[model samples]
Target: MPKLTKYQRRITWSTGIGFILERMDAMFMSLALASIIITLHISKAQGGLLPAITAIGSIFGGIGFGALADRYGRVKTLCWTIIIYAIGTAGMGLTNSFWMLCLFRIIIGVGNSGEYGIAITMLSEAFSKKYLGRLSAAAGVCGQVGSIVASLLSAFILPRFGWHVLFFIGIIPVVLAWFIRFHLPESKEFTENRDAIEKDPNRDFSHWTELFATPAECFLTIRIMIMFMIHIAGYNGLISWLPSIAQERMNISVAGSSLWMIATIIGMSLGIMCFGIVQDHLGSRLAYGIWLLAAAASVFLLIIAQNKLEFLIGGGIVGFCSDGMYSGYGTIVSKLYPTEIRATANNTIMSIAKSVGSFSTVLIGFLMDHFSLMAVILFLSGIYLVSFVIMLSIKELKHENKAPVTTTENAEKVAQ
Candidate 1:
């Protein structure tokens, strides 16, 4: 591989840092939720509603930010999101009332909504298509590192300093925004479309409408969206219950659960990197299908494992297969849309999928309360099968740049 140019290097650094910060903000809440509920004297039902509120805010925020990025610029939108999330995170520490905490979570969600979409689109546009999968996977890996960092901090800090301190630590990401402003350049694709943007400065970019206007586009978008929903639902649903499951099933401590989660995250990071390389070689469609099936089987294995070592191994494999395909989704979305509408299209589909997954957390938790772990795992595996079928239905969008005549000639030659 050739050495990265100054611009490409800057893109990688900014994206990796930005994604890490955003992911820390995203996963911190889940890791600290039990602590937060105990500290605030809230019930599990109320605690569950907080994430739902955040998801609701994210749905609207994603569409709004997507339009804003298309109209104004990606960097400006990202800067504002970082600032907003920082304030919300700090405020989450200060709020004593349940409703007030939920409100703050909504504020955080608004910032979190567009963070992934803009970063993925900007980085994808910055790098060459040949390197897009690797770079996208690298970002996913960075996000997992952030999750690991948050988990480590929660393990060390939450017991002594309390959950409030965790929110206070979120100030780091807010400060990182200034660095992003100085270091990250506007995407080349966005820059090239400046003239068109200038001509319609006030136009409303309804990404949902644009994406669903045609049958083929709608089919592809829905397939990706369903896959994302299943991935998030399965991964987050299991992880959210992991500590409780460990305590109930194996008589483990909170700290021990955190250690298990760390192991799972390590597997996630490795899987992200490996998936990128595999998708590039194997094609996204096939890579996604195989991984989804593996994830389903892993989830089932996780529920039945009686020994701690087997349980942890199953958890790691579940993490690897479930979260591994995330990078491919970004790469596929980038390839699916043209430059003009890429950010909006990517954000709209992904945000709704994320929202669905987030909302399902409560439902999953409720089911777990009533049913066995094995039953929940089986239900989640069924959802993964839905995603797998959807993924296989979509036509592969990679390698679209090759000449159509060349493909036709090759087909004719093969026939001879």
Candidate 2:
């Protein structure tokens, strides 16, 4: 991999920090949920709706702002997204009513949704293809770090300052908005593409239609969407219930569960780092195949564990294999689509898949109610297996060196 230019480093940090803020806000909301429910006198169902509202906001924000990024400029749109989410988060602190808080959550979700797709698009334009994977993964690792920080911050602040303070802390990232606006440059590839489009009177680019303009593009998008669905399903299904499972089945204490989370999260971080290296050097297919298979196998470790130590180790392996490949999806779509619709492709596909995948928690609960814990684990393992097969069947493309958006011929060139 080549050394990064100063601007590349800035983009990387901004992207990474953006992810960190996203994760931190998510964690704070999760940790403060119990307090928010009691203070607002809302039922469990209404409290649950808060996150759901956020998810709905994310779906809309991902598509809407993504199109805006393609039309406007990446850095300019990114700054707006940051400000939107920051203001929404801080608004959550001031709201006294349940409906008001719900509205703010929607705003927060919408703002958070654009960061990943836009940042990934920007990075794709800024960095060398050779270094893209690791850099993306590094940013993801930063997100995991953000979760850890939020957890620690919640532990300290929730006791002293109350849940509202958590939302207030989110406003701190607004300062990052200023730094990004002034320091970061627009992607040269996107700028050039915009110029070319402007110069040609006959040219038409619709972010949504560009994704499915041809049969090949449609199929490619569908296949990628399925892969994303599987990825999110496997993650949400398993991790959502892992702690409860460990507590119920293994008789682990709350402290033990926390340790298990730390272990698993560390494993996830290390796995993401390794994925970056492996995918960058060895190619995405081999890296994904290996991780998916490992994920499928590792879940069984949870089924067989006899002690807390074994369960913790199993959780770590599961985290490593199942969640580590998260960043690679951005790298994949970035290569397949042209710059004009790249953010849309990334956000639209992911938000739709994520919206679908969010049901996995419910599905897992249904499965657990009807069947054994082992059965639920088996189901998750099967999701990984299906993902592996889908991954293998997709035609691989050679890495493009210069073009922001790949031409069909370049996009279709099979990897040797």
Q: Name the best candidate (by TM-score).
A: 1
Per-residue CA lDDT of model 1 for 216-293, tens digit only, reads: 666767777888877767766766667667766887666677777888888888889999997777778667878888
**Tens digit per residue, CA lDDT, model 2, 36-68:** 767888754565456556766778888888888
lDDT of each: 0.76, 0.77
Model 2 RMSD, rounded to 1 decimal: 3.9
The candidate 1 region of ten consecutive residues with least summed lDDT is 401-410
List the candidates' TM-scores in order. Answer: 0.91, 0.86
Candidate 1 accuracy as TM-score: 0.91
After superposing candidate 2 on the true structure, give the runs of residues whose Cα lies further than 4 Å from its correct spot. Answer: 30-52, 94-102, 158-162, 181-183, 243-259, 365-372, 397-416
For residue 59, give model 2's deviation from the true position in Å: 1.5
Count of clashing residue pairs in every prediction: 0, 1
